[model samples]
Target: MNPEEIGLEKPGRAYFAPDDLNDPALTRLIFRLGLPAVAGLSINAVHHTINMVFVGMIGAHEIAAITVVLPILMMIGAIGEGLGVGVATAIGRALGSNSPQRANVTASTFMVLAVPMGIALTAGILVFRRELLGLFGASEAIMPLAEHYLIIVAFSVTLTMLQILSDFIAISEGNTRFSMWTLLGCFALNIILDPIMIFGFGFGLAGAAMATILSQIAAIAAYALYFRKRIGTLHLSARFAAFRADILKPVLSIGLPTTLTSMLSSISFAVLFTYAGFYRGDAGIAGVGIALRVLTLGMLPVIGLSLGGQAVLSFAWGAGKTPRLLAASNLLLLLTSAFCVAYGLGAVLLRYPIAAIFTDDLEIARIAALTIVVTHIPFIFFGMRQILVVLLQAQGRARLAATISIAQNGYFLLPLLFVLPHFLGFEGLLASLFLAPALTALLSAVILFTTLRQLRGDTDLPIATFTNTVSERAS
Candidate 1:
């Protein structure tokens, strides 16, 4: 697992071990780890926006088709992301506790588990494609397009899930550099294939899907070789892939909340689409969808920063290095808060231009810009909420993590989704996006301030023990 073999860094730097996470230069480590996570993850997430750009050329209806599919795509990816978080937490804790075997088992086991679940998800989606698509707000015109894109997407869900899981496994061991290269490889290949396949090959919407799966295939090969060539510490060999209940429990405890959080967020998108469709039509749906994608691209830095910090946070928390964990949390929140403010303002100012890039329809572009302004107005407060959710998860406060995870999308957003639309009509629905996170952040503040107060002195007190949140419930 030499860094040289994987092209991560020069030899003196050393591959990240659990102990290596204790580096006193906390700011430097965050940037070193955070930058790669941001680059790789941002690239992966941005490709979807790229896909929408190419598909937007076909028509608003085609854009609408992809829009509706976006929720379902997020739902599937949510499972992988959630599980990957679980894997990272478990392995991070294991390595922090100096248990290499435990780390090995967690990586191998999840790698094996994720693929079959991906296959199952694909099967189920394919079996009930019409029902699922309609449930997500697909109209007749969009249904055929959605199916065309979805059939190919369904088959590759397995690969997508594994790709996410693989990235986290590598990151968990502090191998973010490997994670970065593999994702960058996927991004570069996707960019190359998209235009060629969409127009050159005459595949249209289906071409985008083919390009995605093919790029994913290439990324998967890189991960396989990383292990096969002994470039990473954790091995995905056959013997360790066998399931064990002990491994499953803790992972699921942290992961289930994460999945629920992401699913709730994904479901919110579907519900938003449903309402947008009901109030406006394909145009409104297209408009809102474009706005959301634009917002997603804008927020990638925030997400990347959070993930990079998460790896370090989990490692420090696991090692019971309270002082380091405390410092890391402080810096993470500050950086997140600062970045969100800057991006939110820029996003609002540039809304019209950003929306214009996606579609030629003036109606769609206008609606998209309006949606962006409506959604981002309250973005300043959300930074705290996002970082707190990561902090809670890293601390293994599963119940709190799950609660916060859904705070915006579920507790606040869900009721708003239903009630607001009924009262204020479509404007109310759009308002819900602004209101949910804004409200959630205020509440997040209460919880966060209390915890920060408790650890104010950073005494050598073993940061509170982090057991599975499920176990807390059972007790």
Candidate 2:
């Protein structure tokens, strides 16, 4: 153990080890884990933007169809996210607590559960494709395009789930760089294939979905290859027989809330979409969709950093490293606040230019710009609050996390969607998006502050002393 004792890649330089997390400089550790994730997510967001541009080129109708279907697609992703985050948190905590055995078990169990669930989802979507889209308020004009896209992409769910889980597990093992590379490779492949599939092959909407499927397949292959090299402590193998309740419980506890939170987002957005359709038809859907896609570009970095922060916080919590936990909270607040200020200002200043990227229609672009400016005004508050929610999950405060997640949308967003439009009309619909996150942020800040205050007074070993002891033991 000591840094000196560990072998360097070359003569002078040392690569980051999982044990480096135990180092006292919590902020450096955050960047080491976070920056790669941010890069990966940024590239991923760019890839999506490019994909949207390609789809937009198909016409306003195609883009409108996509917007109508976006929430339902997000619902599919919600399950994968829940499982991935849950397992990742479980694995990270296991490693931090020095229980590699448990981490491996969690990984193995996840594969067993996730694969079947993905397959079932694909089958179900294919069977009830129309009903599912209809439930999300897909109008008659958009339904055909939605169906066409889902026909190809639905089957890709298994691979998509695998890719997501692999990325999260890799990050949990402190191998964020590898995860980043895998995602970059997929993004590159997706970009190269998109035009060829859509225009060259003339697959249209189906072609875009096919291109995405192919890219996900490439990502799954990459993850499998990387995991075979076994860079981390969590190893996925054929251990279906050794499945234990203990390993499954922690993963589910953290994951279930996270998954439900994501699904709620989809649900709330779908409800908003329904109202939008009632008020403004395809134009409303197209405008909101463009704005949301643009907003995602801003969110990618924040989410990447949040994922990094969550893994670090989970490890620290499991290791009983209070000072490191406090350091993580402070650093997340600083980083997110800075990002919010920068991104929010950019959104406000370049709202029209940003909206114009997706569509040539002046009406859609104007509405999109308005949506961007209004929704992003409280960007910093939303980003910090999200990190706090993830921290709650990482620290085994799943009930609190779940409560926050549910209330943010269910209690706040849904009611706004119904009431705002009646008074403010179409503008009220967009305003609801802004109000929900703002209110949720206020609530989360209060809870996070209270939690940190309690922890500060607790009789736990300080991070400085803990780091010194670890160093001495290593030496």
TM-score of each prediction = 0.93, 0.92
> Would you list the C-alpha lDDT of every candidate in the order shown?
0.82, 0.81
lDDT (10s digit) by residue, model 2, range 159-270: 8788888888888877777778888989999999999999999988888898998889888887777667565556678653255778777888888887888788888888
Q: Give every collision pair in model 1.
A: none
Cα error of candidate 1 at position 222, Å: 0.3
lDDT for model 2, on a 0 to 1 scale? 0.81
Give the clash total for candidate 2: 0
Candidate no. 1 TM-score: 0.93
Residue runs of model 1 more than 4 Å from their true location after superposition: 1-19, 457-475
Give the clashing residue pairs of candidate 2, or none: none
lDDT of 1 by residue, 84-176 (tens): 999888887777667778889888888888877988999999998888899899998789999888988999998998889988888877778
